[model samples]
Target chain A: MIKQFPIQQFLDENGKILNKDIRSQITTELVKNFYQHCVRIRTFDRKAISLQRQGRIGTYAPFEGQEAAQVGSALALQQDDWLFPTYRDHGAAMTFGHSLRNILLFWNGRNEGCIPPEGKKIFPPAIPIATQIPHAAGAAYAEKRKGTKNAAIVYFGDGATSEGDFHEGINFASVMKAPVVLFNQNNGYAISVPINKQMSSQTIAQKALAYDIPGVRIDGNDIFVVYFETLKALERARQGQGPTLIEAVTWRYGAHTTADDPSKYRDQTESQQRRHTMDPLLRIEHFMKNEGMYDEHWINEIEEAAQAEIDLAVQEMEEFPVANPADIFDHVFAEPTWGIQKQKEEYLRLLEVNP
Target chain B: MMNTVIQTKTLTLVQAINEAMDTMLKENEQVILLGEDIGKNGGVFRATDGLQEKYGEDRVLDTPLSEAGFVGAAIGMAVNGFRPVVEIQFLGFIYPAYEQIMTHASRLRMRTMGYYTVPMVIRAPYGAGVRAPEIHCDSTEAIFTHMPGIKVVCPSNPYDAKGLLIAAIEDPDPVLFLEPMRSYRSVRDEVPDGKYIVEIGKGNRLIEGEDVTLISWGAMVPVALKAAEQMKVRGIHCDVLDLRTLYPLDHELIAESVQKTGRTVIVHEAHATGGVGNDIVSIINDTSFLFQKAPVERVTGFDTPVPYFGFEDHYLPTPKRVVHAIEKVMKY
Candidate 1:
């Protein structure tokens, strides 16, 4: 018989702890780190939206209300574990050591932006919905066969679960016992189609039941729950216990992208209400106040520091040399095919003749 | 190493593929096999038979029936520095994994601007003529050739299959190696033992003539050669060029053959409309059109889905059709 899976939360919307056992786990240093990273990413998200508005960057997808879900799960990863992110998961990528400058360049349509820094197993943002699901499964399986304890974590939205790749990835990982965490952020909209219209299922977490793996539903606005639960799922993977599906129940306050307008489909009043009631950063600030650790001086310092870091990355991305047009022809293959060679030569000849 | 003598062995096309995988797996620890029924069952076509028993389960994985999942995972493994060779049971079944192959695996190098290279090989039994039921007999490789940043290759015999599969796995790019269903056992030859590299993006000029250049790959190579043999009886000599790699087509070879012959007749099993033959004709027209003696003709399948066995032979490009096209081009 199918049963209801309750959403788990350590901190409620009013900065109250529903789980008493988590009280001792909340350290001053931990909360401070969460607050700082949260502010940093939020600032970056806002700046990206502004850049797109000014034509400084191409279309941008903002993660304004999904900071905790990104930061917490990313923080839970070991250095060697792989991370597969989607177009909207750059906040998670940045937290996991992707360069801010590269992130900016990616929005500007440069290929350099797609690359992760050396030794970081972060994948390029999968533009196709749920395509990374199987890729993450395969990479994690590779680690298992090599006798390594390394695992992988992949991120997608509620909309991606509808794609065939979602079920395929889940089924394979379940059967092979691959070490992977399928992190799903139920953001309620897939380019204006709400979750209610997309699927008849009550929850994305329930889809994991058909595959027979652990499915978890959590309050993504509560960083403590997101962090601890992801850590547990990853541990199960490292222990060879197989994969886990985490459905992070969250919301998106901004439009899907700079090119979209949310006002057409949904009411702005509800979003304004959620900002005060369920904002992840505000929840943490409230917790710090209750614990007597809230400081205006520290908050201002983090704010100024986040602004400075974003400013430097913006400058670096803009100042980088323009990509060569010939680069488009090269690297199609390790050795360019004769056809590619001919096309490249023909293209250049046309330019020369015209000039 | 270059001075060392190469040993040769006689085997079927499928056997040659197994041998190539065996040698590669034994040679490199990083190489692994993943596919449905690929482990204990050896593969649906037996192309990867016995590799699992020899290499063990860790290296030779029998994956669940999820083409998109497994193929995408192979790409993931590729980016993480593992050389994964994936086997899709049938070419028609590749629709499920097309998103992975086209959107991600093919574009990974170009999108990342060379920071990431997917060093993997995807092998599938493609083409028709063995009377396979449905979906399994699509010879339409144009779907893959149409995409850039991916090397599309089809080996016509045991020797080239072995060498090309090896080269595909080792190369720092994703390669689609199509093993025609008809050639599994029907086509056999003296395949060399030990390692050999049949360079990708090059055409093999199987036979030489001056009347017309007959161009094809995969299953149709046999048809082209047969037609060439028949044409020779009428003193209509023709040059037969096997395009081993379709995407990075050996235009140089096509150009030279077309220039000398001053005529061309392209044959393939796919529909004539969007077939890679059309691409070849376009390339020849662009490069060797001025030297052309007659309009290029194409002996290709009808612009329709591969029909049932009732009309299969009629649908396929027969040697008679190739001869007709050759005769028509020559008379012009």
Candidate 2:
């Protein structure tokens, strides 16, 4: 049964196009766009990890190897569509127009990091596992009921498929015909737990069969497949075909977060080997070179530009005004309750007396 | 030259709840209903009877039996500009969805730094005395009140039930509406025909007296009223307060009544260890300690699982127990 859902790929590791049907669809402009975003997010993820190590920011989750999966799926979304991302999917959020400064602020332990830019339908990064799945369904359902073509895309890892919310969310979407795409990045681990320990299912995509929805397993390292498949799924959702689950089979090349040590749970050599042979960036670079679309000067320019942009965001994040302690009580509700009001007053009074 | 009439209907607590949802569904297109068996089945208790027929299946959704799924979905809908009122078949059946409520719905506003608010209500039928089976009669309001960002409202009668349900739906933050199963159809009262909000965080003075303050909410309000009546016969005047909102308890009312009377008895059907009663005690100590005539007395269920229905009567705080507590506080 698992063999039925073999990994689908348009581009192979050697940069050879496996699916000629999409050859006409793939353009030089699309490849460059995917290339720029993949590089931008990878740079950000590595910079975040470095900042965490230097104590410039709090603990950070790195998506160094999963950049293609994040960038491709996010690029497929419409401006009005919703993006529900997990805590580890800031790469996708950034690709979907989330403020880099706010993402940095979030890692720095400030609530201001949670706010998206105005009119961007991006939810705050859901920290709890699989909790955002149902939220995506409901939000998409809202759009559907409003008779709008806007859809939603929710990101999760392979381990999240073990959670009850995953089943519940997909089931609800399937039943209501809610316009949503349950995008799964099979990054092979949930913190320290490996996929084998996570679930017995051979492929996360197969689980969508239970909901009677279309499920596709694809090579997450191939940028073309990830982007085109997600675009197809979003198209289906807009056409009122309900939900589709796309499983991007990929690997995480680093520890789950700065606080973790991946060497404790698994072999570290696999990451080193994958970086040279199976990296998403390398595969895309191979494709660009084979297609004669690669330009060394242009690539250097984008890298320099991405670095400057990220550096400015870092400075802004660091220089933002100190969080007012009163904010803790103020946003608990639209209007503070008497209990919260009293507590806030007492706290402020204590601060004054101490100061 | 105009004639005016304020229409009213005599309804039980559950019927009044239906009317409130009916009114909101008619008034606001954003209002949606979701629960198991809530559509054609009118919910397990019939609180949503005829709502689906009137509003169509899109508005009144009969969801799959997964509480976390629908509740979490409702949270999403609320964030997406929908006012969702979800019905949990029973309060005890809500544990599966507790994570969503605590981690998401309750704190989404604060988590998002006020970028989003969850204007949703969760209605659960709670409490023992109607001989409900295990896990069906747990009155665990304290578990929710311990958290911030969510308001907990429980109504003891038809009038308060109707008004508070409407207010809960209108509230900008998440609200947990606990409907006392025992009091669902136990009594009737004249409910207004249209919309009216019984303000959240305000306690109602059921009866005013000077001897002692009897404080309770939900099904225990009627018990406190009964105790106050019995105390009145013995030349003891009692001030009875029905705290409709449990989370942001009415501090002004609790302090004023406790200070004026100089003695108090708190009643609740929840376990005594960490009940909302403890919070009330803390409030009395904080604000009206100087006026205390005696230590505050509490009449509450024991710190044990609400036993099987055969022993449920023993586990529940009755009017007799409330009267005993008032007497004990008075003697001290």
Candidate 3:
């Protein structure tokens, strides 16, 4: 049954155009933009992991191998559209205009990191699997009700697809004709559990059939395919055509999180080999080079620019004021509950006694 | 003869919730409903009946069976300026979305340094009298109350349900609104027809007395009231304190009642161990220990899974149990 939705590829692993019909959509400017953002996020992700290792930040979820899936779909979204991201989606959030300094702050256990830049409809990363599905549906539905063209896109992983919220969100969006995109990155494994053990379903894309929505299976490593398909889905949603379930077949070359070790379950050598053949950034570079769209000076400039941006973000994050422990107890509600108030008071007393 | 103007008919608990959602959707552009079977089906319990038709499918959404997905999404929507009211179908089924509620919805404001807030409400039907399956009727209020950033509210009457729900919808913080499925239609009152807001964190004194103070919430409120009426015949004046908001817990009201009565009994339909009743007892012990004339007595369900239909009556904290607890406290 899964074979029926054999991964659809617009561009092959070698960066050769596989689907000539859609090649016209790939302009030189679009290609360059995709490469630039992808490189920018990739660098940011690597820096975050390094910071985590150095005890500068808390545990981090690396999106090393899933760059194409995050970058492509996030880039396709309009500025006004809503983004529901999971803990592993900071790459997508950064690409979608979330502040880098804030992102860094969030990793460092500071409350300031959770805030997105003004006017950016980026939600704080959902730690629980699949919980953002219904939220995205409701938000998109609101946009539709307000007579606006703005849609919403929610990012989740293969593990999240098994959650009930995934089904509920898709079902509601399908029934209500909500303008939202359900983007799933099928990276083979969800934490330690492989996809095969997660569910009986052969493919995540087929789950869309139950909701009676359009489901597309794409080669997530091919940036062109991911970008074009995501844009098409967003367009359909904006046009009042309802929700779309996109299964982006990709891989995660890193651990589930910094707290996890991937070698306990999966083979790491396979991931290293895939880096040369099916890498999203490398594939984009290959396409650009093959199409004569890549200039050595332009490529170098993009790399240098990405590094400088990351450096500034790191500096800004470090220069921010230290976090206050009292901030943790505030804002559970507009007015603190008695329990919270008591707990906060107790915590402060403990701090005072210790100090 | 005095001229009289007739008012609109009173609504049931379910009707009150539906009306609240309808009123909010009509008044605010951001208010939306999302849950399984909420759209064309009007919800599994029909609490959202006619909403999809009146508000259209966009406002009244029927979602897949993805609790975590929708709950987290509602948090996202709330942070992004949408007042999303999520339904969990049953209290027992909400465990999947607990992480989102506890980690994100409850803490977003603090986590974001006040830059964002999750002004959302999660509604679930709870209690054991409904004879629901093992997991369907669990009174999970304690779990939510344990969380720091969210408000937990349980209304015993239709009027309070409607008013508190409206308040919760308008509240700038996330709220957990637990509606008793068994009392959805069994309990009805002359709820105001128009919009009204009930103050959160305030307990209402249902029956003022001098002998013992009975603290209860949700389904147990009715049980406590019944028990108080019964205790009246025995010359035991039982003061019934309905804690509308479980988290904030009108400590002032409880303490005042305890000081006046000199004794207290906490009643709830959830398990006796680690339930909200224990917390109430602990609070009274901590703050009003010197004022208390007797050890706090608790009337609650047994520490076991909500039984099947055959033993539901035994499993639930009945009016008899509440009355017995009141008598025991009075004796103390």
Candidate 1, B257-314: lDDT as tens digits = 9999999999999998988988998899899979999999999999999988667899
| TM-score, cand. 3 | 0.89
Rank ordering of all candidates by TM-score, starting from the highest: 2, 1, 3
lDDT tens per residue, model 3, B139-224: 87888888878889999888889889999999999889999888899987887676778888888999888898889988888888
- Clashing pairs for predicted structure model 1, backbone only: A135-B72
Alpha carbon deviation, residue B84, candidate 1 (Å)? 1.4
TM-score of chain B of each: 0.98, 0.98, 0.96
Q: TM-score of predicted model 1?
A: 0.97
Q: What is the lDDT of residue A130 in candidate 3?
A: 78
TM-score of every candidate relative to the true structure = 0.97, 0.99, 0.89
First chain TM-score, candidate 2: 0.99
Candidate 1 residues A1-355, lDDT tens each? 1248788899988778888987888889999988899999999999999999899999999989999999999999999999999999999999999999999999999988988898898889989899999889888987887789999999999999999899888888888899999999998899899998999988888887898898999989899999999999999999998999999999999999998999999998989999999999999999889989899999999999999999999999999998776888886877777768778999888888994
Grade the docking of candidate 3: medium
User: Which 10-residue window of candidate 1 chain B scores lowest in summed lDDT?
Assistant: B131-140
DockQ of 3: 0.52
